[model samples]
Target: MADQVLMELGDRLRVARKVEGSSGAVLASRAGVTQPTVSRVENGQRVSSVEAVERLIAALPLPPEEAERLTSMAREAYALASEGKRVDSGVSLVPDAARKLFTAASRVRGFQSATIPAPLRSSEYAAAAGADSDSGADWAKNLDDAGKSFEFVVTESALRTWPGSGESMPAQLEHLLTLAQRPNVSLTVIPWGVGLPVMPPHGFTVCDESGVLVETFTATMTLTGSEHVAAYRDAFEALAAVAVTGDEFRRVVEDVAADLTRFIQ
Candidate 1:
């Protein structure tokens, strides 16, 4: 994972440099680092200190906005490396390039139009939702890890809907009730009575600090471009605004679980 993050960090650094219209040697000279250090840093063969990270950002001739984005990404990479956790493995690799963004994320915003969000899903619920092959197991494990790593926001529709086994619905509602007890996790339900339109045609998962993963049945789309992310951020905030919280949210879960029992029977 470290190796993957290192390589990914290098790739982002290199991309930022190119986007700034600069050369590696030029950046090294501006940042007061040796050319090889610059090369290694960009290749993930070496980690850069916070000071060095700042210098590299300074070396880029990008506008203040773009430079700040690069700096934030660099700091995230350094922090992940410090923890010895690879940002490029497990569910991180979903949708390919989104892996890099998730590595640097401080928060996550997820919406499930058809099923419960993975992080809030129970082991049984997750299995029932889809196939139980190695990939599914990896996804469940990844979802569990992500739950520990970020602040999760879920819609009410996702919380109540059951797509798999009959018992899975009640189990899923119970599982979410348990997860919501965590300080880091915040679960909200978008009530059926809410006047809001359906979440944009696409299902999107946003990194609180960076990137957006827009998924489809066939392919997962990773969005890192600032403008695109900003749009999704707006959409997330809007969805969050109408979601049910606290006691009301929990009540909805229990009610849904009870309602689902009849189907199973």
Candidate 2:
């Protein structure tokens, strides 16, 4: 799957460069990368980093929509490469890999500082935020699997940040409240004004004890190293220690939803 995606992305890049009448050397120069790097990318081989792929895509004269699409594809390809059955799965890009991990894991631990965890997101919220609604649907089905367990700790800011339209937030928050009722799911919120021993710069998801998916602005990294996964697991435990659950968690969601309703009105 990763190879196919990369090949398709490479084809798109090659075609785009051809359409612009730019040679690989010229395109590499414009992108501030070597010609070989450009060739590697054009041939569907792995490059140095996601940033490198982004630079190549940016150097092209494609439309904004096209550029964004290609960039997304590149991220997914890199993600899959990192998670492939290699000894070094550290810091690779792929949202699909994360989804697969989530689906296969018996336990999922997630900590989000800026947005709702993907599994708990409502379809409307996911669509409005440009997130993969199919992932949300997949998670929704998984939530009913009694053998699987999910634990999430989200910040108050994440709950309050309106990724969708004004009215949509209320529904999203309500959705969270509903999901929190599940016996196998544990949803907690770290409200504002709470002092923390540590601050995680980004969100991450740990699938059982095997892998950790770290979310970043430009790419998603799948870390399979024991030490890296252990570090993230520790961070999650620290965050969860300070987070509110049960009725307190419900109060936070309701308060945010009410505030959003009044603001919209």
Candidate 3:
């Protein structure tokens, strides 16, 4: 998959250079980088450091507002890369470039306040929770196709309360168990027994590469900006740090299901 963030960064730089009517050598000389670095950056094959970006922005002689936007986008790309995350920066709710990235990209990192990621929501859970909007018939099928992988972190209480999940709860638990074993998915549970050392951040989804989708009670917000994406990426990584994975994590999920089984009896 193309690194959308980097590609955007490069495209922005090339545009700015063109608008300023400067050659690559001119920009490089002013930015203190080599002409080749400028060339590669314009081509999206190389990324400039944050400091270098600042220099490039200054050298672009772009209007102050345009320069800041360019630098901001570049910084976002660097931040994601530094954190070991990749972004295509093109994700969207519709069948566009972004949506294509969503389906084709290999990895997506996410954190949810509720149990189970949106794509994994059972038909019952989705209907009860009213999450069926925007995400259509392709939702479940897309996730199941499996060229993409996911790392999801959720709280244990999320599992305990599914408002409309009655008989579906058992199937839901079993569904999670099955998904957790899939090579493409990594599920982590933050058990109820532990307390967070700090106040928790809101939940967000880092769509493969450069997109972040966050929803509040009122409406949903999608962030394609680099800094916003980086912030959510950091947030997910922090939450994952405290989560339990592997056999112990699987056992926790199973125990929840087992308790539910007894409750059912």
Q: What number of clashing residue pairs does each candidate have, in the order they appear?
A: 4, 3, 8
Which pairs clash in model 2?
A: 78-93, 79-93, 79-94
Q: Which stretches of candidate 1 lie over 4 Å from their true place?
A: 1-95, 131-153
Candidate 3 per-residue lDDT over residues 67-142, each given as its tens digit: 7787777777766666745563433444243344456656777777664566667777666676635443345566
Ranked candidates, highest TM-score first: 2, 3, 1
Candidate 3 all-Cα RMSD: 12.3
Of 1 and 3, which scores higher on lDDT?
3
Residue pairs whose backbone atoms clash in candidate 1? 10-42, 107-208, 156-189, 156-190
Among the numbered candidates, top TM-score falls to: 2
- Candidate 1's C-alpha lDDT? 0.65
- Report the Cα RMSD per candidate: 14.0, 15.6, 12.3
Candidate 3 — worst ten consecutive residues by lDDT sum? 90-99
TM-score of each: 0.57, 0.64, 0.58
Q: Which ten residues in a row have the lowest lDDT in candidate 1?
A: 131-140
Ranking by lDDT: 2, 3, 1
Which residue pairs collide, candidate 3?
Answer: 4-88, 86-209, 87-209, 87-210, 88-209, 88-210, 90-98, 91-98
lDDT for each residue of candidate 2 in 57-111, tens digit (9 for 90 to 100) = 9999999999999999989877876774465546566557766777889999999
Candidate 2 positional error at 212, Å: 0.6
